[model samples]
Target: MRLRLRRFRPRTGPHEHRVVQPLHPLRHASLRDPDPIGHLLADHDGLNRLAGLFSFAAYSRHTVVHIPLRDGVPPDEGMGELVDLVLVHHSYGLRPSQWPGLRRRLTHGTPLTVRTDEARTARDAAAWQARAHRADRRDELRHTTHARTFFLFGSRDVFAEAADSFAYAAGNGPLHKRVQQGDLALVSAIPGLRQPPGGGHPFEVLICFKPYPPYAHFKRPGR
Candidate 1:
């Protein structure tokens, strides 16, 4: 997977700045695939890539990645397409004021506990509701996590831009309901420099966002 670096800034409020730690795929040949368990293996008791400012994890059989930008990029035109999955750790992902709450949650829990797990549980519940609402559940995609990680599913044509609201629209009608349900967020599609092993099919982008109240204000386009 290819990686890009960026930063997050709160629109308003006090913030705790996180350090930027880079992920080197070359260090671990086994990282060819962005597997959640792979990330844990790489964690090495929180000393590995999983502990870095930017990292990836496996959630619900999908590769979930996290990234912490050093400077705010504001989701501009320069944003590229990501290959596999990306994890973003920043206060902007959630409401500006909720940062402290998130930090407290993380600190109060076990050292290894990730606050995002709370959202993931919420996401699973939402997905179950979605399934119940649908008449045909065979093809339904479950909302596995609520980390606000954007995914392109290897669709390089997907594009993203800075928006005044938390919502996004790519003109995919069938996805509208899912987007509205907070199952996913639209983000600028970025091209990662790394390709899959043996130059196989295109990789996708998955970004795990920081949990906070700021996240509740997301208003997608064409909602």
Candidate 2:
């Protein structure tokens, strides 16, 4: 993706200042032979299969797929053939009956910010360590924990900017503050029992926004 520099002003601060930041263009990966999951997310038949798997807990409800942008393409400027469907499982903190209302509000689009700081990282590490001691659902926990770390820290810059932008738009309120309390999850596709016959894994990397406290299953033992 072409890196474009734009001047951005802070929306919530004592003093407004202009900063030139690079806007990263994001797009879906190719849906060709090598990437079966891409094809799965792009077609109706595949979505039906995915829905079935979700019903069986094959995937998490908080999942959101991400794909690298095509090189040299601007986000607003069309992606041409690289454009494809993305699955966003935004079932966190809501009942099945409430999904329709949320969907309607997000029909056009919404800003999603991922924020991480020293405190947030420490909390995540503590949570991971807590999960490590448990034997229940060990394999699933291990995969998700490792994948979450890899995706978040590996692309730290991108996420940082995203968080800043979100804060600017939505205000840094209590709602946004929960992100620092360990509400994010990343589940990347890996080779596992769920692999399809065509080769690639049946799922894409998922960025999940989970509920806080009692609703969230993964938490430190005492808390």
Point to the candidate with the largest TM-score: 2
How does residue 162 of candidate 1 score in lDDT?
10
Candidate 1 lDDT over 73-129, as tens digits, reads 222212332122233322124332333443333222111223223233334434444
TM-score of each: 0.21, 0.24
lDDT, candidates in the order shown: 0.26, 0.27
12-128 per-residue lDDT for model 2 (tens digits): 225332222123332211222122332111111222222222221212234323222223222221122333222223233222333233323322333333222434433433444
How high a TM-score does candidate 1 get?
Answer: 0.21
Error of 1 at 43 (Å): 26
Candidate 2 residue 35 C-alpha distance from true site, Å: 14
